[model samples]
Target: MGIVSVSMPEDLLEEIDDIVETHDYSGRSELFREAGRKLVQEFREPSLEDRDLVAIVSALFPYDSPAVETKMTELRHTHASAVRSNSHSCICDDQGCVETFIIEGELATVSEFVRDVEATNEDVQVEYSLFPVDSIQRPTL
Candidate 1:
């Protein structure tokens, strides 16, 4: 319908192409369109009733960004009560790092913390996305 230009590393583009071929997506545009729709639906600001939901929050940034590590650490500490688990890893292409925080609490808390982290991420030029998911932890018998 519309065209948007995005810059991605060569390897990442190749991987997209591979996924498109393997998964039978119409093309790169169709592949990205699906991803875009999913992101929008998951990341949109939640209504009051949805505030108690749990979700996984993801962030990507250059590993060497001057303030990324510190800022992320600060946010984690600031929201320690809500942030349940965290993980960090180098991206597949090695252009940057990726981090994930599995947060459990009311949606309000999760959304607020994610917004703060995302704003700071913007200052650092980091990419961020959040996906809402059911709380997956199960109780032992």
Candidate 2:
């Protein structure tokens, strides 16, 4: 292993520290190493760059954040052709809302939509899974 130096905003570093303490990470270095591995796995998987895809995208955010909701709506419109269906639900305890979309399109378009949702709000938690269109098993008539 080699040593490398990096910088982050103090507030962000503090958040990392909090997680490290809460989760009993050995130290910042160990925490960062694990995070780096997870990120690499997320971006380098399945290699479906040129294929048509079907995806499920979901975002969770505090229910009171209208800005997040509005941004999500704008992105949905911008990618309207890719979106097949959308559903919203409030968590039973009323603390948060989840929005889910079933989207089908080329890999690039689906990835762009998911990236936009992830960038819309730092507080929003976004998750998505993509499957190549040809890989899905279709029912025979």
Q: Which candidate is the best by TM-score?
A: 2
Q: What is the per-residue lDDT of model 2 for residues 1-141, given as tens digits with 9 covering 90 to 100? A: 989797766988999999999999999999999998996676556677668889999999998899988988898898899999988888968899999999998766887788899889888889998888889788999
Q: For all the candidates, what are their Cα RMSDs to the real structure?
A: 6.0, 4.1
The TM-scores of all predictions, comma-separated, are: 0.54, 0.73
Cα-based lDDT for every prediction: 0.73, 0.87
Q: On residues 1-141, what C-alpha lDDT tens digit does candidate 1 reach at each position?
A: 778998767877999999999999989999999998886665565543464556577787776776887778888899999888888888767778877887777656866877777777553343433444444466899
Candidate 2 accuracy as lDDT: 0.87
